[model samples]
Target: MKTKRRAAYFFTSLKLFLREYRLFVLLGCLCLLGGVVVGVLSARSFGEDYYKLNFIFELHSGSYSFAKTFFLALLFGWGGLALILLCGFNRWLIFPAFFLVAFLGYRLGLGFVGCLQPSGAGGVACVIFFYLPLYLTAGTVFIVYICMVFSSICGACGVFSSASSVKRLFFKALPLSLVFAAAAFFSCILIPLLYKLFFM
Candidate 1:
């Protein structure tokens, strides 16, 4: 009964958060999509050599180890969260955050294009097994963090400029941010394991 109540409360809070910040979520998605489209188009012009030069591709080509992958993902996830927190202090910082999210998408697009180069089937599998989980997890982290930062900004700024408003915003976002962080960490761990299971 206690667990059931907790679960219900969690869902209700999640629904409220989504309802309140859906526009920010949509904006993040659009930016990511735009970057992806650009990356896919550019990949065709740049050719395979260009993607080979990419750090992610280089890493992917190397040994698939759990520690290395998890460390890298954790680094990126923490870095993204740091950027979002920085953005909360100043409006100008949001531009860099936006660019970073889009850049992630661009990288994803490059990976997808590289995978699909020779044939479709293997590429589809790679996307399913690897790219979707890894990049999508990162994307989810960014979107949630960005939404939280945006809300905090609104609370601090002229809009919603009450002490209680700011406090409420911070407390509400804190738990969600922690949840996303854990999700990102789990994805990092999961990705390498998945690679070993399917590819190795």
Candidate 2:
């Protein structure tokens, strides 16, 4: 009964969020698409020689590469969540959060650009097997965080405004943070193992 109530609340909050923030989400997605378009267009200058470079393929090998990728995803996932929590208290942070969303979109775009590479099957495979699942999960979490922060900022200043608001925000943030943390965990372990299996 309690679990069902919690699920109901989650869905209610999500419905409200989507209705309220649809425009903002759409804008962010457009920015992400634009970044991807730019990344693909820019890759034209990279040339066949650039793709042919052995270092590009070789970099995917070794424990160092996997370690770096795992740590970076972990850092970004948790760090971004931390930032969202910090920003929730300050309305002034909305602009910066907007930019951060755009930047995340840009990085996603770059990943897509890598997959679109004409000659580098290794790069394509890396994007597909190693990066896509992690990014999709992490990126969804990021979008949720950004939207939550934005919503929190819009409501009231800081976490101490009211007892009800505090409780509400906590409940909302808890699931999103847990989901992102799970994504980070998987990105660290699952992504690396998959990378080794396919790429190595």
Candidate 3:
């Protein structure tokens, strides 16, 4: 009887948390969808190195061979992360940049992008293996934490401070973005290094 009651209570608590962090949950769901889409599209385009989401440029042996693949990863990963953050206005990001990039990239008819666009084929993993799972987790953490902080601050300010909705939103987003960026960045490094240790 106690076990069943405890389980029910735990689930009820979980329901409360979920209700409180609905924004994070929503962002998590969308980012998850984005990851799968990113992963699949990457595999189709990058072939073997789809795992690294590099080899699209910098060449295994070419003129810019000294530049390395890490640059590609950083560049695109940062862009994608920022796009996910700044533009995620309640859905699919509120900006045309993300929309256009996602569409222009994803809507190439499900084939390989390297073949289609000369500058295509840069990508990375989105599937749940480990470590990288925290990429989404970190982002979601930021989302939830920001909401909590934002609400708390607004409440502190009596909801009628000189701060407009835009100001409040900015406060919520900027700090959260920075925190998430740090977590995500570290995760990206950690994932590759950890994977390398085990596999390579």
Alpha-carbon lDDT of model 1: 0.68
* Number of backbone collisions per candidate: 0, 0, 0
- Report the C-alpha displacement of residue 173, candidate 2, in angstroms: 3.7
Per-residue lDDT tens digits of candidate 1, residues 1-200? Answer: 99999999999999998899998788789888988898888988876544442323444677445566666766776777666666666666777888888988998888788766644675666566566666777787788878766766654352245567456655655665566556555554564455556755
- What is the per-residue lDDT of model 3 for residues 1-200, given as tens digits with 9 covering 90 to 100? 99999999999987997898776556545644565477456656665432222322323223223224334434544454444444433332333433433442342222233223333322333223322443344445444543443343333233334357545654655655565555544444454455446644
Q: Rate the local accuracy (lDDT) of all candidates.
A: 0.68, 0.62, 0.44
Better of 1 and 2 by lDDT: 1
Cα lDDT, model 1, residue 133: 66
| Candidate 2 TM-score, C-alpha based | 0.67
| Candidate 1: 10-residue stretch with minimal lDDT | 50-59
Q: Which parts of model 3 are misplaced by more than 4 Å?
A: 1-17, 20-31, 34-38, 41-48, 54-134, 138-163, 189-200
Question: Model 2: per-residue lDDT, tens digit, 91-124?
Answer: 7775665566666666665655554553467666
